[model samples]
Target: MRFTFMCKKDMVPIAGPHGRGKIAIVGAGPAGLAASGYLVCQGYEVDVYDKLPLPGGLMSFAIPSFRISINSIIEGVEDLRDNFSVKFILNTKVFKRDTVRRDEGDEFTKNTVDLRELLNNYDAILIATGTWKSRKMNIPGEDSKGVYTALEYLFLLKSYELGYLNHEPPKANKVIVVGGGLSAIDAAEVMIHRGADEVYLVYRRTINEAPAGSFEINRLRRLGVKWMELAAPKRIIADATGNVKEVELIKMKLGEPDESGRPRPIPIEGSEFTIEADMVIEAVGEIATSPFPDQEYLGIKQDRRGRIIVNDELRTGNEKVFAAGDVVSGPSKVGRAIFLGLNAARNIHLYLTTKRISKGGT
Candidate 1:
């Protein structure tokens, strides 16, 4: 979607300086970049900060290279950098709310920066940090050495694929992937491509509940990745080396539909079984838990899921702050985040330039 910051002819030049207001955007992913693009177009100086050495967040690490070419992402970022007055602060994390707050003291705190200081320095701030926390199964032996979250495994694989790692690939032969979502399929496919001798996708429900699109599921089957449906992993069995050796599973049957409108899987009595594998990967989902506390602080509010709450204009309760992407909407597709980023950027530009909020706060 196209996003522009041009004002109506009658409402031009009423807010502040033209293209002179400073804006800080957290996270260098699609949302952050998109916001930067629109803000820059409207004459705002934009600086993007990220914890990673590179931009693109999950798009750069979690997604397989085959699905999204690295060159394309680089080109997009480069375009924004060249055309817009955009600065990137990589390898720097905004760990605490104070990091973005205005400083009351001259000295810096450990792993914390003053948010108030940032507010005084910049005209506005945009929070676009995407969800990086992985959800755990809470099952036994989950802490086993060979167990990995989907993002962790994918990040390592993509890093290796991008020449960030020179060592031999991790040993993952006879691997079992838990979950039926797109991430689960991607992890399974990558494991096989990376030389896993056997790959099995274990799902707690039927294929209908799998997160993989039909076309992708068909492709996986064609590629020979085995699917164990109606199976729930109960525990990870490890050997003396603390490496996963087998997984205990319980057979499940479909019951009443759950909140997602999908039939819930009910564990069957005395229907336990075991599958031997060298490694296990969990691809359930991700959560957005800000390093900052959820209570009222700096005029920001968090929803029940711990995502920052924002209005339609992407503004938080605080007038000077805005938010977008996964940090506000929870884990979602990259394209959706980009769309919201653009919208948020435009709204921010409008507010900064006209001093009047538009229909959409963002």
Candidate 2:
């Protein structure tokens, strides 16, 4: 299916007077882009800043174009820039403080902007910096050369495919992806498309309990992607050159429901097995990433898991700042993030018009 943002009837002509106020949105992902569309239509001067070279963020970078057409995103972004006067500051990362913290999609960042500077310059600020850091299994030999996070692997190939990188991404003959999420499915499909002779999708839970659902998993299986259910990686065995050679996996069984309301996988004794692999991708999950290192910065607080804390109105502790999307609710689909972005945009318009903001840090 095609994803068109500006083609929709909601892409209203610029309404209200210009110079309503300057709004700075960090991260040009789904939420940030959606908010920009809304605020720009409302006649606010919107500037979207992202570390990537393109404006669509993950939609244009990490995610494969087959799933989300980059051309559609580019068309929408072009509409915002040409018609509504939205400015996208690409290849620049917004940071609260100068630190060495970097995420998967930050490889192409050429410049940096301080959060404090944006707060002082812009009339309003929105932080929609979605999840960027990939979760690791923390198993032995995980730091091997051939072991990569799903984002890193996908982003590298995507960067090359988009002509941002000159070098080609490495091709693996035998690949193993660990997870049951969409990322895993995407990774498996990519490997298969890249001519990998063997691709395996290993998940800790059964196909029925997978986060990506059985339909996607079964689809991958039919595409010659081996499905290893009720199994989890215990260790990544490396060759003498420190590259991944094989992965030691342990069988698992479903136990009582855990905090996620899904049956937790319990390790089965004496069920360890080793699978040969040229490359291993960890697609377990991702964590919310903000521009700051501190838990609380400028009255914006993040939860223990790194999700930005917000209230019913989607306002941050600072009256002039708001947040939305995966950064606030953790990893979510594009549709959910878009909905949250539009909702936050409405709240922002309400705040800007009335000069009264909701009190929230929850």
Candidate 3:
């Protein structure tokens, strides 16, 4: 049957006569989506599983629409569905290998699949599950009311704003946002747009060292967002009602460079102060949550940061398995993840075709 698609024609020719190969991909973020497109062009059947109700992962759900175009993601997803024939098992999580408890996220997952089952059934498997576990500040009262990880806060707000969620987000007169990443900027802007009387962004390092870069900070400044540099949240103080009443901050001085090549922040003794705050958003970052539970038991290795160990080809210790995007490379921009996904897809194709050719005498 003839087909119509918005994307360009077939990709560069690959070896061997095209044969139908079925593959399973976990997570429908930029990585998974890009992988599916490339694989489909290679004439492979692809099934993508995700916990969220639809595709587009963080780009579609977590990030503020003002910072990205949701419609563009929607269009790209539709093109994949209509033209590439990528099957998305939405609202389903490819559950971890050996875990009693399920991983929870902002979205409600309605179905679950065993990771081991997928490993056994598919011709090849690709894990593109980006870091879903938000990092926290090991400070007192961090668990108090009105405290939110940037991921959860952004997901909740974006979902509500998009009408997928019915409930309104938390109302705050004074919002305090921690960190200096894209997530931090997104949270601060959303708060101001939602009528917060004031929004303050606290960063331990100078603007040049910020993950979001100085441009984003300057943009926020133009919007009346206050930038409080060289300070870190020490503690969150709550009122009788259990809501956030204020935040304790410690002054920081730049020290020697850390692993990220940025100057380390050292707290100055006795240089602490308190500020009135009703909401706090921590955007420190997120860690990768491997879909394969007890990965060590299976002989797979992960770094201290919880990133999967992969070779240049993005293949794990298990030949049948491969990983791509942020899960393997650590947190990065969407464009980079998509490129890595496409590259991983090529490697998977090579592995599959090479095996088939050897078995059939080429």
Best by lDDT: 2
Over 4 Å off in model 3, which ranges?
1-19, 97-107, 297-299, 356-362
| lDDT, candidate 1, 1-362, per-residue tens | 12223323343322333457889888777788778767766667788877666677778767888788888877767655654436777766665653342211111123344456667788888888777777789999999988998877887776666666565347677999998888898999888787888899888988877767667777887888888899989999999999898999999999999998999999999999999998999988877644355454578778766688888788887788888998888878788998889888877877887888533231
Question: How should the candidates be ordered by lDDT, best one leading?
Answer: 2, 3, 1
**Cα lDDT tens digits for candidate 3, 187-267:** 899888989998999999999899999999999999989999999999999999898999999999999999989999999
Each candidate's lDDT (Cα)? 0.76, 0.87, 0.82
lDDT of 1: 0.76
lDDT of 3 at 112: 73
Which of the numbered candidates is closest to the native, going by highest TM-score?
A: 2
Positional deviation of residue 50's Cα in model 3 after best superposition, in angstroms: 0.5
Per-prediction TM-score, please?
0.87, 0.95, 0.91
lDDT of candidate 2 vs native? 0.87
lDDT over C-alpha atoms for residue 138 of model 1: 95
Q: For all the candidates, what are their Cα RMSDs to the real structure?
A: 5.7, 2.2, 4.6
| Residues 1-362, model 2: lDDT tens digits | 22234344765556333688889999899999898887876778888999988887778877888799988888888877777778889889998656768788777889988889999898888999999999999999999988989988888998899999999778899999999999899999999999999999999999888889989988988999999999999999999999999999999999999999999899999999999998999999999998887899889999999999998988988898899999999888898988888888888889889988668775
